[model samples]
Target: MNLEETYRSLGLSDAEYARVRELLGRTPNFLELSLFSVMWSEHCGYKNSRPLLGRFPSEGGRVLQGPGENAGVVEVGEGWALAFKVESHNHPSAVEPYQGAATGVGGIIRDILAMGARPVAVLDSLRFGDPADGRVRYLFREVVRGIGGYGNPVGVPTVGGEVEFAPAYTGNPLVNAMCVGLLRVEDLMRSRAVGVGNRVILLGARTGRDGIHGATFASDELSGESEARRPNVQVGDPFAGKVLIEACLELRRRDLLVALQDLGAAGITSSASEMAAKGGVGIEIETDRVPLREGGMEPWEVMISESQERMLAVVEPERVEEVLKVAARYGLGAAVVGRVADHGELRVLCGGEVAGSVPAEYLADAPAYEREVVEPEYLKEAQRLDVEEIPVPGDFNAVLLRMLSHPNLCSRRSVWEQYDYQVRTNTVVGPGADAAVMRIKGTKLGYAVVTDGRGKWCYLDPEGGGAATVAEAYRNLSCVGAEPVALTNCLNFGSPEKPAVYYQLARSIEGMSRACEALGTPVVSGNVSLYNETSGGAVYPTPVVGMVGVLEDVSCHATPGFGREGDVVAVVGASGRASLAGSEYLEIVHGRVAGRPPEPDLALEKECADRVRRLIAEGLVDTAHDISSGGLAVALAEMAIAGGVGVEVEVGSGRRPDVELFGEAGGQILIAVPGERWDEVREALAGVPWQIIGRTGGGGLKIGGFVDLKLEELRGAYGRDLFAEETG
Candidate 1:
């Protein structure tokens, strides 16, 4: 191939190649070029998103470690720290759903492990096309199986997550996985490769050709021929991953390492270079020393293999044998492939001859493009919807049934049941709840986490969609009575090179930043995945936010379920702001995906969540659920189905029944309290809008005593089988 063809094929632009040459002061060899290709790609380097991502609020006193780390760590009281991060395996999962998603789980687990934390739980945020399409069905099934396949064996509980469906995701489905871990503050480990003479050890699975160009593969958009790139998707061994987690923790417990980094994305190239760059030093790797799974692998292939279940750690030379012994105990491959150096560049040596040499900082810091941003013209039409022009259904009962059966609003028991969510025995609240709560052993501390986002909302109004996502997460944590502390996100979007896509990315961050700042929940660590386009079109901009909260006492927590009869159900926070715009009710019943999503009131959201959290903590509420997706009606239905108890209440207005009952809005939470204690609960939430909407009791769901459905019927519709068949 010609030089330009070579550069373009490597996923490098002409200007990027020229810049590389300038930095190197000469032409580079095949190995050096390959290193730059993967490291500088959007997957490894935040080349396209780094500048835009800075708009997030990322600082707070509780943030022990914020952005630019293996994973963000937060102080969760009692000297316990939580390290968590979310990453997207979109392109890979689209190509090879099983292994792509399985390996994705393995990748994030190691990120927490690298922080010297024991991965405690896993949460996934998924978006797919219409499940009626066989291709979408197959993708959903395999992706869930892959997640359970990896997380179950790896022993991390797949606690809680959210899933939504839309036509825009038909070809470009999104699979964002999050892993949260816990460690003592003193045990936190940084990724920097410090100490010049420390030996860099490669531990766990042997390097393989299965994931050769995985990083570069994830850097671009997919096409009809994308399936042919299956080889670029990593093959994972969760058995190895589970062992590596235990072994690495053992190493940390023994205090045998100076630093640790997981081998993800570009594998050794990224781990080694990022480690060296972070420490302001260098690394000299011997490709021949790395253990390979196959024979006849070239040095360049070995250097940037994107192998799964591997880690690089800097150990004192004197303790090298001890570290190897720990690996041997776990029956993992161990090799001393490199060493920290004072040279300030990552030097690759093959057969004792220099193959590639580049400054570590050069590979770790790719060119950040502040792309031109322009509001999408199509959005003007897409965001325009008249609620008054829409027809209101005569039978609200039938509408409620359809909404319950809608794929986006239906129950996820079939999906989450496949996961061993109780594996670690720390899960106090798992799948059915608004968020997952895990207890800190031997302490009163409880860590609550939830993942939330809506691609359709972002597609309608990126800024509003972004703010709404954060607000939902904050509300979820508050509903469960946890103080939302910090958040990590996975920003999934189409090519940022397009002004429209860049605008979405930029505005979404702005909205999320505002919400985070207002809610006192700062962004910690996150991953931005771009180029999620295919033949069908680009998926909606989905910035999945995973927020983590802390509860002072695990025993005092409220779930989204009715506990007793005659408990009064009340509408709390935000007044008369429900909009049919960008709602599940609008899409399912109206057959349209237009309308500007209701912009979130960040200040009101904070006030509402804070009040709800206080109510739960003070034992004032028996149940709490935030209104989202299908709005107040659907939220009430979910609570009824979960508790096997029904609600009888008056909720709606003179406006269209559909708009008042099923309209989507943020900063509003549905709460249940004893009929006698309603006065006290109302007094506590006096500042926020609080009204008696209904009472919890009976065998039927009755709204204003008009729209009514049997409890068993609601359950039947909500639990409908989603994957009974697959067309793909």
Candidate 2:
């Protein structure tokens, strides 16, 4: 290929070419150009979102290791630590849903395993187009199946996750997976190739030509011809992944590994170069020594191929034999493909011939662009609708019932049941709760996690939506009586080249930063996925927030179910009227996704969360559930269904019945307390805004004459399996 053709194929602009030339001090050969291309791609480099990602608070007392590592590690008491992260496999999922989604699970599991932790649980945050469309339905089914296929065999319980549907995701679906692992603080592994003479070992599956240029494929926008790029989607083997996890942990246990890193987006090129750069050392790789699944593969292809279920390890020269033994027991491929050197450059040799050499830092550190941000013109029209313009349903009961049956607000039991959520028996509280709670096997301590987002709200008001996303995740953790500590996010947005998408990205980050600072929860690790648009249009600016919190005593955590027959149900942080804008009520009842979502109050949110945690800790509340999406009524219905009991509530004369019942708002929670403890609960919440909205009861849910329904009726509406309904 000519020089210009080579540069274009490498996904480099003229300016980037100039920078590469200057950094190398000469023209790069084909192999060097290919390495630079994959490393500099937006997926690997974070060139567009890096500057904005810095806006997040990334340090805290509990954070043991933050953003710079393979995954974030936080101290979880009792000398144990938690390693976790959330990553996206969007573009690939759009092209090949099954393998794309399956590989996403495998990739994240490997990331957690790289930290020398045993992955205990997994969660997913998914978004797809309207299910009425055949293509969307097929994609949704396969994605879920894919997630289960990988996570189930790996023995990591798929505890909880969130899924939403919108028109914006029709062309390009999103699949973000999160994995959490447990290990002793001392057992933690770092991903730096520290020892100069350490042997670089390639572990697990053999390299192949599949998924070549996968990073560049992810960095570009999807088109009708995206199917032709299916070769860029890495196929995963869960059985191999499970075995690889075992081998790595055993290696760590035996002190055979000096450092470890997972081969993801850019494969060996990224893993090897990043390891060298992070440790301030150099690496020399013999491409011919790499175990390959396919013959006749070019040196560049072997370096950049994103084959799944593979990892790189820096092993002590003396322990190489032992490391190979463990990998052999697991039937995994292990070969010494490289070595750490003092030269500070990444050198590639093929057939004993030097093919490429470049400074490791140059490949690891890509340029960051400050894209122009302009507010979207559609925001005005989308946010113009007022609550008054939408008529209140004549029968509030019917409206609540309809909202309950809506897919976004309905039960996910059918979905989560497909995977094993209690395989290791560490799941204290699984799916269907405010957050998933898992005990740290040998200690009294446990951790709670939740993945949440609001695409409709974000589409209408990006700033409010972003703040609300973080605030809601914090509240979800608090409802389970856990103190919010840290978070990891997946920022899924449209192309950054568009000014509107750039504005959304910037404003959302700003809002999330403010919320994190207020809540004292730093963003420990995250992944940004841009260029999510198709020829049709860009998706709603969806920023999925995954938050983790700690529970000092696993026994003290609360669930979203009424524990007593006559417990007083109260609403906390319900100081203001609900906003109908950007609500399920508007979308389901009015058939419109318009209006500004209520602005999130960071101070109020923190206060409410703190007080709720205190109340749960003091044993003043038996159940706590955050009110969101479908608002107070739906929250009540969910709690009632979970407890198999009904509630009788007095909805005092309000502005509008529908608004009081189903309008969406943030910072509000429904708590159930013993009737005898009502006075004490009130005194404990002295300064907090609250009201005795209802009482847990027997057979029927009564709402002050506006609505009255049997417990079975409410259950029937709330428990309809959306997956079954849509697929059948």
TM-score of each: 0.99, 0.98
Q: Can you give the lDDT of residue 299 in candidate 1?
A: 88
Tens digits of per-residue lDDT, candidate 1, 1-728, equal 87778878999999999999999999888888999999999998889899878788889989999999989999999899999999999999997888878988999999999999999999999999888888888899999999999999999999999888888899988999999999999999999988988899999999989888898999899998888999999989999899999999999999998999999988899999999999999999999999988999998899889889999999999999999999998898899998999999999998998888999999998998999999998999998897778888888899899889888888899899999999979999999899998999999989899999878898999998998899999999999989999999999999999999999999999988988898899999999999999877688999999999999998889999887899988888876888888888888888988888789888888888889888888888759998888988899989988888898988656766777789887879989899888888888988778788878899978887457899999998888777763322
RMSD of 2: 1.3
* Candidate 2 segments whose C-alpha is farther than 4 A from its true place: none
Candidate 1, position 173, lDDT: 89
| Candidate 1 lDDT for residue 597 | 78
Give the Cα lDDT of each candidate: 0.90, 0.90
* Candidate 2 residue 626 C-alpha distance from true site, Å: 0.7
User: Over the stretch 1-728, how does candidate 2's per-residue lDDT look in tens digits?
Assistant: 89989999779989999999998889998899999999999999999999999899999999999998889999989899899999999999999999999999999999999999999889999999988788998899899999999989988899999988888899999999999999999999989998888999999999998799999999999998899999999999999998899889989999898999999999999999999999999999999999999899988889999999999999889999999989998898999999999999999999998899999999999999999999999999999986777887788878888888887888888788888899989999999999999998667899999999887888899988999899999999999999989999999999998999999999999888988998899999999999999999998999999899998988888899876789999899955658888889888888898889888888988998899998888888759999898887888888888988888998775568787788788999899998888999899998878988878988878888788898888988888876667621
> What C-alpha lDDT, on a 0 to 100 scale, does residue 611 get in candidate 2?
94
User: In candidate 2, which residue pairs clash?
Assistant: none
Q: Which residue ranges in model 1 land beyond 4 Å of their true spot?
A: 725-728
